[model samples]
Target: MAGDRGAVRRARDWTRDWGRIWGGAWHRGDGTILAALLAAWVLGVSVWPLARLFLEALAPGADGVPLGLMAEVLEARSTGRAFRNTLAASAGSVVIATVLGTVLAFATGLLRLRGRVAMTFLILSPLLIPSQTMALAWIELSGSNSPVLRPLGLAPPPGTTNPIYSGGGIALLMGIEHMPLVFIALRAALATLPADLVEAARIAGAGRLRILTRIILPLALPSALAGAILAFAAAVGNFGVPALLGIPGRFPMLTTLIYQRLNGFGPSVAGQVAVLALILVALALGALGLRALVLSRLSVPLGRGAALRPLDPGRARLPLEAAIWAVLAVIAILPMLALVATALSPALGVALSASTATTANFHEVLANPTIRRAFANSLLLSALAALVCTLVALPFAWLKVSARAPLIRLLDWLVDGPWVVPGTVVALAMILAFLPPLPLVGSLYGTFAILLLAYLARFLPLVLRPVVAGAEALEPAQDEAARIVGAGPLRRILFVLAPALLPAAMAGALILMMTAVNELTLSALLWSSGNETLGVMVFALQYEGNSTAAAATSVLSLLMVLALALALDAMRRWLPPGTLPWRD
Candidate 1:
């Protein structure tokens, strides 16, 4: 019986070795083909447009000098004004974001509070809320008829000037909108604190404030600044806030100016607008580069240690928790309540009441053919983008994990370029790339194809990131065994690789869908007649002076977003840890 068992084992080993010899080359060929296809798609979809945008901005002058278009744009007073406005607003907002975000991060990251998960979710609410929706909520909050403020007698009179329509207002609101950037960064920095350094500080006769000021702040400053820079970049790219507030406020910004120019004159002014787009991209990139410099220079190397323990504030705990919760309610909960109230009001300036409030605004918005179409379009577009991104991300991640495809590795950096820059810049690049007719795919301009291509370029990285993470976590033995059993690449991927990676891919797709559905920046530029999206619909309704209708539309969009988020949260048990973002 022992001899027979040995013979059977030897026979199995010989079969496996034979299978591996035959299948390895076939698998390599399959990966190469898939990699080549993915490379072409990325190059055409993403790289070409950015290159063309730069070239358009560098159009030669009659005197044969390059960058003539850029020079002309810079000479314009409007350009200068917009540039000044953007800088001032971004800088001011960064200050607010840094202060608020740092306080929140320190509170939540250091102290063990009741309902930490709930508090953290509320703190990061702005990131999930669309910029237009956030702006609308604030507009409702400070309005004369605001439900929250009116009851407290804090709202201004009906005809009094609104405060959320100035440079300071823009800064204040944008600061709140981007606070999560700083919160996330500093939270991560705090989590990695060296236990020894903190203990040493405590033993050296240092009080809470002193340890925080001397040790914690010093160690956390780089992360704080990096988050501030990121917030600044996000503020500069923000169109929804500036468009809703700044346009009416008569404060020009590069993003709004570009939108106005292109919308008014069509693509005829694209060359002129390209220069502004280039500036926006430059500012974002320059800030990111500065962030890299700060992280490299200011970051302190620390030995690996246990995670920092929660601070025992003793008597201060309840008050501290109360304060944090209060601020969160003001920033996160109030605006949403205000928006719902406005939507329920019979008229724009009417006070919401039990008897007076009605569903007329919602009924009208839902009944309108245009808004209904916009909803359908957004749903379809987001779904398609999510579907396509998941499909492409799979092979891209598969090839990326192996060392065989160096180009895949290099292109991985390129993939990040689109996501890192502002959405307005990516939209402009798309217009430049496909506005003109192409072979067999002529003139994607004024069509859904352009939006699809732009979204693929812009959002593919969202899915790719998770898929890559999932791929890295996969057991190598399964893949090796598959290969040894005579499985080809496609078969292995279908049978062995995809099942393990789908949950992560789906999590990412859910993100992409939620984001793309409520997106304003890309849709603002790329959307055409009959292609109006949810963001554009809200902007249009508000621009048309239908405040109640806009409020209703915004409320609906917010519901859709929240629904998607909750769905993902419900699936957290099935998903990989840290993928859902809210809890683990």
Candidate 2:
């Protein structure tokens, strides 16, 4: 009887709310508009630039170049070597990042390791600073007269060899810089492993090492591999690290090669850079596809009950914990101390005199007009991109939840597809999409707008994921109840849904802003003539050979991001008691 009454009421409700059905249809039409805009932004920022670059590379030369000239150039000795070096670096970085991150995650998550919280924070510290800073720090530390180690007999006396300029050094720095991301992902994966399975393994008399080898590795492999592959992608597209470390040794990766071409400013070479960028993008996609396939097979359903059980390490836990903390501290603090020394030093050549270690670098940077302009531009650009991304992501998330349109259903996939596309390729696509006769928009090429558009395309997924989480937490019945109490759609949304999802939106914005502020690859390729950000300035200052000033600038940027992250964290924690949907 209750089922029959519910069916009858639902039918009557549908009849009475025919206007809503039509309104949903209208909303579907609106979704098409959304799709069109999103498609334009994605194509402009991801596809067109790549196409233009390829076309320019393949175009006939002034003397009627042969059809296969571009291919021949790609096959040339230097290009072949660059490709090989890039692949080798990427593969090495991936292995190191994954292994280190997974081991750290295991020590902290499953084992009863002490100082886990502090160690985790330390491990993630590298993400707060730019890779260029880390490179410079390593470079300074490896110098013969480095201030910190000179008295300890660790610094090479005067003419001793340094590891900082080797490909091995580049790989180590890139791996350490990217390890934090894998740590975060795999740590979560480890923390969320099924307690029941772990307990069953323990009950079966499995030794600690055996359990870790057979159980944890298989279970955590998917996310660990994902993080590792992403690290590879980052390492492959990384220009700053290679420029600082590899270029001096004449070891050219794909990223360094592209930057070299861009600096050369030749049409043919720039087109070849674009071609390389496209190839990198394809590689990124293939890796992600492979990861997705593996993850699908090993996908474990997550829920509240899937939380980890602390695996007791008997009497050996304290020593293990101490070792973990010690390693994490070295990983985090050594580079930072090196950075401080670099910034304090009189010049690139570290003189260990107290007089040389003055605040002049900071003062000079503060007084310089270019530094001031770059700082201001970074703050403005980050703020604008954060706002635009958060706002755009909200409607997209809403459509994903409430609308049944095919476009809405596929919105998340579209937003996330760019993660597999290299930033260089994305920048090139934007340039190609708006070359000429696009009139007003075309003129804005090489402007701040292009950078912002590229950021939106690149990071919308980061913004949308948290938003979708917040949106999903909101029950549709809340909107229905508000309508029952005489509220309209706009009123219910403004008063009910918006407030419910505000925290997620803010979280998304903050994370995206963090990325925008420190983003190197795309911004390196696309930052305009006059609209330089701190990141661009850091790289430029370093390349122009002002290591002290570059280190000072990097320190300033790191402080800003740290403060922002702390403030956002506090905001999330102090939300009004019941305002957040998750709280209820």
Candidate 3:
């Protein structure tokens, strides 16, 4: 019996080895699968819908007018002005966020800044606040009757001034929303730099400014550029800021322009919107491609057993550090305070007008039926979607990182396709993909299931990236040892792998949930009555001219996101300080 068992095991090993050599070489096959999945996802999400919208726009009418008449309406003076306004706002936002993010990261990471922890938290805190709240506060400060301005003699006194509601206001909102990306990217990049190299240059008497401009800047430039590109893309795609701050002023970017073409102009204008959307797609792809290219070229590989260094805070650096700390703190605090103030205001739109403001908005928001429905829907749908995504994502991630199969490699490309695809495109494709003979499970054409699938496509990367990283950090010996003790595959996974992957898995899920809750573009198109998420409700209120309700819904969305971000931040600290699978 023992001999027979040994023979069977050997035979299985031989089969696997042959399979690895000929049909399914580990990572190669994995890469193939990844590519295929990526292709399927892109076709089903971005490419297909874009084609549909474009075709609809190009379709001719009985009167011989092209269906894309919406373009003509948008090309009018008002639409033209809005387009320029969006470009100006997006450009300004990208510049501001990139500059501030780089400076803050360098100050905190390289300079051994005082109050670093507090400063870091402050820079990141605005992420917890909704952009709508910021708009409200800024509006208050700019209001002719604002109490906040009275103290500083900054008020317009009786009835003459308001926050500049042009391109600048939109830019400011985008900057506040995007600043965190810059900080995170720069911080991570700086943390990985070889300190010994810097120390050697310092010992050789390199000046601080010279060292930064010559060495630090060049080394960090790729990461900074990558982050800046991402920030730029985000600024370009943003609808909330443009809708809230710009739309009222009649300003429009490509995103808002696209929305107007579809919602305002009707189906006849679909072709023109499709053409414009293609432009947006091209720009987004270009940005993503540039970042990928730069990162690939600049990245250096570490050999086995590379030595690592710890950051040291020296006595002589205290004052410089204090200055850095102060800047980061101010940047972080002001915006958050503004949001909190707005959310707690008794009157939603009457910013800066009175000191009599109370928590009426919060109470009203909490009691509202739409708010309640959105909250429940957001929570349940996001949670369910996250779970489904995590499960689906795990197998894909495993194929990419572990199996090393050619097919899996093909699928890896599919995973990345969603990153470049537009949200609108994804929603449209899902609608098409689920309509007829191949309708998704449960007639999901108009149900929560479609939203879940859309989200999975949009956000599976969030869950997969971290989990794959965790899985890779784990050693094969752990599993082998468990198997030697008679543990089956399922038992070994349950006992050893689950705990190891939990942190990363949870991190991914939280990120996905936050994204799903806050997402607007796709949700706007895909969500139905049965699945009315927070974003859709907010959009509805905005359309109804009930800006207060919109603001309230936006506040709810941001608060929920803030809670998740804070929880994850806490988990990062509470977990042992290491990037490995399990630290002390």
Candidate 4:
């Protein structure tokens, strides 16, 4: 009887301990609020639409789970062709981009080259130009009646097809467009290289070539591979390059195929197209997984030290400098000059000269009410998305770093899903989720609200990533002291954390605004008559054969981007080092 009483007493103590732990966890007001907001955002933005898409794809009859439709879609001949094209183009582009970007990174980051800043900016110009604009510029530059080339007697024969409208052309442009991704990654890795090791190698009488090949290249390999994977994933999901180049070329990738299917058959074909989207998701995720596996094996620890200084190029400097400048001319300056000439010409086929140049195209585009509305809508949407995303990211990042809960970690991964998946998939999911009437907002099918929501979902990671890094670097002691002094959660965040994280948050906001302002892929699928963005306007003008107007619009958008970049450059002193991509 005494033994039984002792057992009951021990059970009561155990139950009380469990209750105390749960009570403490549930009573944390800040954590509870964060959890609730994250849950709502994830469900509304990422989880619901994706879940709905998969459900529809799996069960086209909407009765029960079924795999027959998915299997049938996969077996279709067109689907097989698109799958092959996507893999081939993405792989080819990654190879080209990785090689070019790695070379550029080494030249600018390691060599003592004159005009390195200018060269770096020119190398990264493709990232600022919208993909559609890049395609249009390349087309204009290479067309048979090309004004810029015609003046030099280098134009292709009249009536000859534009060479860029082929599979090889698509791969080349995609490679150029994504080169900046690899450049940034490799440059960062190069910047972190240990100066001590390089100096030690030099002391051992190693030549520049020997040191680079033996020490630096091996250390930078993992970053190069990661960048290649990123380029591949980006190429797979790219819509504008393929749409402008592929359709004319009779080449179709998964993204373009999805667009064609949806445009031709409407949402009635959502299930089939969703299956295509799933394929893209799988490709992107597979690349990312491969990167993870490779990085885990290739990563090595390095001692903390100053980064290596630039090596003297000796007699090779002048020739190397000329080569770099020539590359910049071909990739950036020539295309831009072609775009300008096209914009000034009286008609698409008109050759640009001092006598033939005019500003009528610009005047017409600027005077159009539709164009004006698009500019205003893009500005408003991008600004709101950037501002709201930055605000939410601050708290989300704080919670993510400070909280050790599995739920917070899961939420982080969930938020990244929309970003990793193609914009086409996100747009399709948005359509599936919002096309039907809601309880309060009715239908968001043709509304700007849908675009805004999609932007929020798609670009959240752009802001959140930097903010999380900033938050992780913050000292926890400040928060502890604030709590000790009776400061509430809101007060601590407002007075203590916000000031510290502002620079990173602002930098992220700037990047988000720049990217979202003229976004193409998402806006292409979601835009309606009144909801047109700058990207849609340029694309529509080009597709409608108003090449002059499209060129003018693209030039204006490029100017806007340049202005924003200059503004950020001017503020670099206040921001953390490496915040602005254009800066050293």
**Candidate 1 lDDT by residue in tens digits, 234-336:** 9899999999999999999999999999999999888899999999999999999999999999999766999788787788889999999899988999999
TM-score of each: 0.93, 0.86, 0.78, 0.93
Per-residue lDDT value at 17 in model 4: 97
CA RMSD, predictions in order? 8.3, 8.8, 8.0, 6.5
Write one digit per residue (lDDT tens) for candidate 4, span 1-584. 99999999999999999888755554453465556777788788878998888787786434443676788789999999999999888888998899899999999999999888788889888888889999999999999878778878888899998989988889999999999999998998898898999999989999888999999999999999999999998999999999999987999999999999988998889889989998998998998898888788996778699988898899999999999898888888998989988999999787777899999999999999999999999999989999999878877876677644467778888898889989999999999999999998899988999999999999999888888888888888887787678665566667887899898888888888888888999998899999999999998998899999999999998888888888777778877667766667
The candidate with the higher lDDT, 1 or 2, is 1
**Cα lDDT over the full model 4:** 0.87
Query: Which one wins by TM-score: 2 or 4?
Result: 4
How displaced is residue 553 in candidate 1, in Å? 1.1
Inter-residue clash pairs, candidate 1: none
**lDDT of residue 560 for candidate 1:** 92
- What TM-score would candidate 4 get against the native? 0.93
User: Mind giving the per-residue lDDT tens digits that candidate 2 earns over 226-304?
Assistant: 7887787777777778887898867788777777777677333555666667667667877777777867877676566
Model 4 stretches astray by more than 4 angstroms:
1-29, 60-65, 403-406
Better of 1 and 2 by TM-score: 1
lDDT of each: 0.88, 0.72, 0.65, 0.87
lDDT (tens digit, per residue) of candidate 3 on 312-409: 55665676666665665445544344445555555544654457556666678788776788789888877887897676555555545554456656
Please name the candidate that would achieve the greatest lDDT relative to the true structure: 1
RMSD of 3: 8.0
